[model samples]
Target: MQDWWNAFMPYPDVDVGHASTGPLSGLRLAVKDLFDVAGYPTSAGNAAVLAASGIKTATAPLVQALLDAGAFFAGKTNTDELAYSLIGGNVHFGMPRNPRDPDLIPGGSSSGSAVAVAAGLADLGLGTDTSGSIRLPAAINGLIGWRPTHGSLDNRALRPLAPSFDVPGFMTSSLEPMAAVMSAVGMPATNDRPISILIPEDIFETIDGVIADEMIASLRSSAMPIRKINSIASFSLADLAVAFTTILQKEAWESNKTLFEQSPDAIAPDIAARLRAGSRLDDEAMREADRIAALFSREVNRLLCENMVVALPTLAMNPPRRYAGPDSFAAFRSACIKLLCLSGLSGCPQLAFPIVSRAGNVSLSLVGARSADRMLVNVARRLSTCLKEQMPF
Candidate 1:
């Protein structure tokens, strides 16, 4: 019963000396290890990286924003090695146990961030979602995780994985706190337009039956009208994965080449393998990946039009069982990333809120327009309010 991810730093005293105190003052907040918090070493779940890269001397912009917003920080949480894997397991820091069911694996690379929130250890937790890092864990843990549009938040001090898609996100048990954190972190929080929830026929079909039903029922009860829309004409998920990998690899290779070349033996095995994989992607393939990304972005925008938020299951499958076999891992990872990329491609905002439980598992997901993050927040808030009212004893 020992908490492997327990906070080394106790909750901060917000009222004594901090901005925006008394409101979010005592609220507990946890940051992913990738973010630089002034005096802390950004371990990024790797001992080698911590030793190799010098200690961060200043707080990251996002960290500063959270602190300024009156959040009582609970210290850094665990992450996947170099924030690369969707699964949270690390050879170094043991896997963070899922709060809902200890028998299952907590989704990652934003592993501990979501668990911290789900376990009620923190009011809000910060995580980075490049693929399904934030949303997948949020889905599994039954929490609300919001990944804003690309470039919506500053990435000045965050360690990069896939720079193009590595947007910082937040996890909380409810949409109110998630929206509050986003607003505090500088995302617009309110909108005046009537909300439109778009259900993508192709992507929704991929979700497990029970989870999808819960999500759909929640949407139906909302004050807004739900529309059936198809964005991004049918495309191979495998192709998207190849493109995402090529781009991440090319960027990672360029970013870590010096350190990797200098002390190739010092890096973690998983991270090393990932970097090596990136190195293997051909230049032509990388270019093709970029082309596909651009093509998809345009198509997605056209499909969304305006004032319409796309909705889909946060994860295509259920939480992975702890120590799942290699084949299970592959299948779980594939489903998780495939659904997430729909939003990642267009750089749209996504707000994953857990609606209900089925067979002892939580059902969850997000809906939002590209760059229209404020509208999405408003929509989520309204949806959560409606669901609470409709709940029967």
Candidate 2:
């Protein structure tokens, strides 16, 4: 049977045997094409680029760690062209179907990875979260998506996309596999403990009213005291978005300028346009972005000091329709960036949990201080338990 999900790479499946015994033994794993797999070409979802780039000589250390810990490698999965867009529709490889809602888009560039896990095709899907790539898809597809603190996971042998913001992340059907995968990858072990929840009034307001209310209600159900803060220090969502976009564009241009110049016509028009814009950014603009980003990071770290977690909607609204027009997608993308850019700019750890609202399936996100990746997962697990007991909330 042909898989309508269209999650895996078009090539034949690559099977790396699972360990006889370990934490993840018997677990199925699928990787985004951006991660090198020894001899396979790291396509990054662009056919021409794949044709131009030769096979990788080494496997990414993160993928290797999972295999060593007993996870079976399934195969490479599709991704947005060059891992650039968040919409998930690759002009070349086609978008992965949203297991929860086929009509809605499967948020990307990590689109296939999330779908693979959501559809039960893979127990764990390894992806890269540059700015909500993992979190957005996880939320849209009703799964748990986690983006660790910048540089927390090894990145060697992975394609670069806004290096400063790009971090290894994953999507899983449930928290147990996510926790297990994190443990295998050398994530510091953390004890399960209750943490304080902070609701950033400004960020939550960015989400649609119905979705925001649903998320807030979930937080209320938790015994953790929820504090309403006026702002994340002085930084607004818009400010963070601008700073993050500027830096990302500048860095992306630097990383892929050569590819753009070599085969401009081979890339998708939307992605090509973004690269062109990035090429036009000046050093002064990047410097200003850096200054703003540093300030935002410092403020976020201060606010999230140990034991504090901030909750907000993962995306401003639900995922855009699969065939949404360019103009409609542009507006949706802009609003989403405003919320997602917070973590990218601040370099904090974030986890998105699937939550339903009147509008439809939405995701609630929790942001924590640097090095709090494990803590965020633990908190999500505990909260899941609480929500289950108080079912039909």
Off by over 4 Å in 1: 1-17, 20-23, 210-214, 221-223, 357-361, 388-393
lDDT of 1 by residue, 1-393 (tens): 234554222223222224667446667878898888866778777777777657567888887877777887677888877777787787777688887878888888899888888887888889998887888888888888888888889898888877888899888887667667766777765558675677776677777676666677767877678877554445676677667767877787767777678878767676788798887888789889999988877877776666767777777777679888757877888777777776676688888876644444454455565667767667766776787787663
Q: lDDT per residue, candidate 2, 74-177, as tens digits?
A: 88998999999888899888999988889989889899998998888899999999978898888888989999889889999888989989999989988889
TM-score of 2: 0.96
Question: Candidates' lDDT values, in order?
Answer: 0.75, 0.85
Give the lowest summed-lDDT range of ten residues in model 2: 354-363
Best by lDDT: 2
lDDT of 1: 0.75
**Backbone-clash count (model 1):** 0
Error of 2 at 199 (Å): 0.4
